[model samples]
Target: MNTNTNTNAIAAARQAHSTRCRQRVLTALEQAAHSGDEITVSAIARRARVDRSFLYRHRDLHAAVLVKAAEPATASTGGPSASRPSLIADLANAHDRITRLSHENTQLRQRLSEHLGEQAWRESGLCPPDDIDRLQRRVTELEQHTAEQRRQLAERDDELDATRATNRELMTRLNRPHPDGA
Candidate 1:
């Protein structure tokens, strides 16, 4: 009978300890939520001064933590509430800003690289000579060739016209009656 009484006392003490731990966990959860702090399982466990395994062992407590964690933190401190949509919009804006900055950075880098390359080339004394005079001479030669081709085409046109006129005259004379009939 004495051994059974001792067992009951042990069970009672364990039940009391469990009740205290559960209360502590609930209080910690409320505090964390009110303060707009993160409600992760690890954070709750630490805040409650309870082992992670303890929360896991109590399925109700674990589910409560999960539910609270899924909820967006309410700003009881007069700050902005971090809603899911607002956070996502903020992230998208940040990503767009980063993309724009990256593109600008690439353009600036390319310009700098081009400027440096030109400077280096000039310093190396290997710059190619200007070909303005050569280009001008070539242009003049092509213009003269083009003029000659046009002149030849005009001459051919005049010759063709004259040949057509002569053929018409010959045909007119042949069609006319001869002075003496054959």
Candidate 2:
């Protein structure tokens, strides 16, 4: 690779590492605090496997870390929380709605896929071939929508990489002097 290409690749790798490190640190701090470890400087340092001084140096992040850790988990499928019954109720209602839709779709598709040119099929009073074709088209549209969602998810991942790169650059600049002495 050319020097410029190599340099750019190294910079991108460094930024990715920096972002991963930050996220891992936050996750570790959350788990530690949630599991009843003190969110104090020494406690975090111990949990992070870093020195006490290093933990103190990043004390500003402590409160945010603790707050996020202390908040209840956002997703619950009837786990032991005060509001779990309500969540369960809501889930049950959603399940019923899904079941109804699924049954309706199945019936419609059954009527659709019948033999189009058969006289017996005609007498069976199935949905017209055009309606079946429309339903098939709708299914294709739904599949395309799912593909678009996956593409969007991949794009978001790329953005995360870029954000991580920018953060690494900022941190590096913070720790280094300008080429021209300031």
Candidate 2 lDDT tens digits, 1-182: 69999999999998897566556567677776445444555566566665665444555566665565454444335455323345568899999999999999999887766644466766778837747888989999999999999999999999999999999999998989888888
Question: Model 1 RMSD to the real structure?
Answer: 6.8
Cα RMSD (Å) between model 2 and the true structure? 43.7
> RMSD of each candidate?
6.8, 43.7
Between which residue pairs do clashes occur in model 2?
none
Give model 2's TM-score versus the native structure.
Answer: 0.29
Q: How much is the lDDT of residue 89 in candidate 2?
A: 84
Q: Cα miss at 24, model 2 (Å)?
A: 1.5
Model 2 ranges with Cα > 4 A deviation = 49-63, 66-182
Local distance difference test, per candidate? 0.92, 0.69
